[model samples]
Target: MISKDEVKHIAALARIGLDEKEIEKFSTDLSSILDWIEQLKEADIENVEPISHITGMENITREDKAEDFENKDGIKKMFPEEKDGYDKVKSVL
Candidate 1:
């Protein structure tokens, strides 16, 4: 069984604000997940081969290469705001 304090700690780490009811609910849910994992530990795997993925799909990613932008002026025209010949964006931080 998972404790309420353990649930609170996990919630804090995840930056989630869980009320008393939610905390209680997750305490039971997390305990069930741990119990299921415990059951998985009892499985017999004497000759099982370790595999990275179940799907036998190969990597289809293309090589990363910097391509020259052909539409340099198009971006400036599309941008709503500009400052001193440079693109002006709102402060992210």
Candidate 2:
């Protein structure tokens, strides 16, 4: 099990304050997590294929096509507001 001093040292490194009760609780929790990790060390994954992700999804992308827009007047008419010959939307930040 993790000791009180180890817990305190970890909390100090993380820049978090923990009282005596919290320190004791986290000590147990951290020890349990470490023990679980130790148990996982015995897992059988010799033949398992290494992968970056589990989801079988492919990225869909299109080639960038930059062209001169000739519909400036039409776009200006669709927008609620316009500024400097461009559509003005709400500030994202």
Q: Please give each candidate's TM-score.
A: 0.51, 0.46
lDDT of each: 0.91, 0.91
Off by over 4 Å in 1: 46-49, 56-61, 66-93
Model 1: lDDT of residue 30: 96
Per-residue lDDT tens digits for candidate 2, residues 5-29, read 9999999999999999999999999
What ranges in model 2 sit over 4 Å off? 44-93
Judged by whole-model lDDT over C-alpha atoms, candidate 2 comes out at: 0.91
lDDT of 2 at 85: 81
